[model samples]
Target: MQAQPEKKHSSTCDSKEDSNKLESRYQFCGNALRITRDFSNNLGISAIIWESGLVLCRYFEQEKISFSGKKVIELGSGTGIVGILAILLGGDVTLTDQPVVLNQIEFNVTSNIPVSIIQRSKVSDLRWGKNEDQFPTDYDFILGSDIVYSPHDFPSLIKTLQHLSNQNTIIYISSKMRETMGAIDFHEKLLPQHFNSELVHRNEEKEINVYKVTKKAREQPSA
Candidate 1:
């Protein structure tokens, strides 16, 4: 993903995590689903979109879930596949990232989605706590992938989470746990703030975890 810089004092809370390099490949899934290389993160993560995102789409198609007709937001949407999936399902979506990565995210979403899936979704640049003033206070849902890595980003991330969410909203996140002590512990402490959080799905063989969050309260941290 492309990146935008953070000016000084904007994020005294930013923390650096270990960096790893990843290669590229595009994999095909069932009809209406496809996987492709995301150059963002320098290709560090696979950014798989099928099951995680397709499940969301299928439920809505089956009328088992309601996203197509609601406002949605996704944070750290690397390739922005999930947010676009919601858009296909009929939700108004805000696709957010650090300004640098927004372009890459937009590239993937625009290229893969069908023109028939008409919906409103934006590539909004968001650097947690740095531009707090620009944050929106209301959204129906928030989604993400592999966002719980850097502790430095956690506080600000949580701050953004609380800011965008309201009583009736849901916050969804999915990530494959990496072999890092700090990364594993982030979910431990961060889990408590969310009113309800449960592991909805996972791939134990791949070390991935998907959690659904709802029932948030407003507790503005000085992030």
Candidate 2:
């Protein structure tokens, strides 16, 4: 959760490094701006989103951001483009991911957003289910894009939800079900933990699905 600046990844031209990048991510609107690469760490990545994310852009423009004054945290913020837009719409937002991706996040946010919106965005590194004390307490909403996939990380991912939650926090997850059994299972196991699960949108071309999750409390919160 700490926002310490780490080593800056060389954005130089090295084909070898490019080959190691697990995949390239793009905006949902067919924008070739943001590209993602999983570095050596399976739990971490570096993102290259220029101009903002298309998926995020659509989401904001479709609906006026409801989280106007609420604190919002975007997990695995590859390029942090979504969180930046959230800030534009009036949410107090934090964009988080590994240090590897923070640099690129900086590039995109600074380039696309106006100075006012940029001021509301905070960038930090958060390794889910691990060191998370650096994160803000009790986020009103949690968001992630294309994060779930590995079964091994399922337990940790699930646990991380509780870590960032308060008595009432909404979780929004968007992912493309690209033929992964592990990712499917993760969703199934995760369904029961929430108070409600509903499909928000589906992108046929990308095979992406978005869900809105409400947390259920078994008992009342302590005053």
lDDT of model number 2: 0.62
Off by over 4 Å in 2: 1-45, 48-53, 219-223
Error of 2 at 26 (Å): 10
| lDDT for position 25 in model 1 | 23
Provide the clash count, candidate 2: 0
Across residues 68-113, which tens digit of lDDT does each residue of candidate 1 receive?
A: 6688888777667667667766678888877666766676667656
- Candidate 1 vs. true structure, TM-score: 0.69
Candidate 2 structure quality by residue, lDDT tens digits, 10-111? 222222245545333333222223333445444343444322134435554554446688899998888565676566567888888777777766666675
Each candidate's lDDT (Cα)?
0.60, 0.62
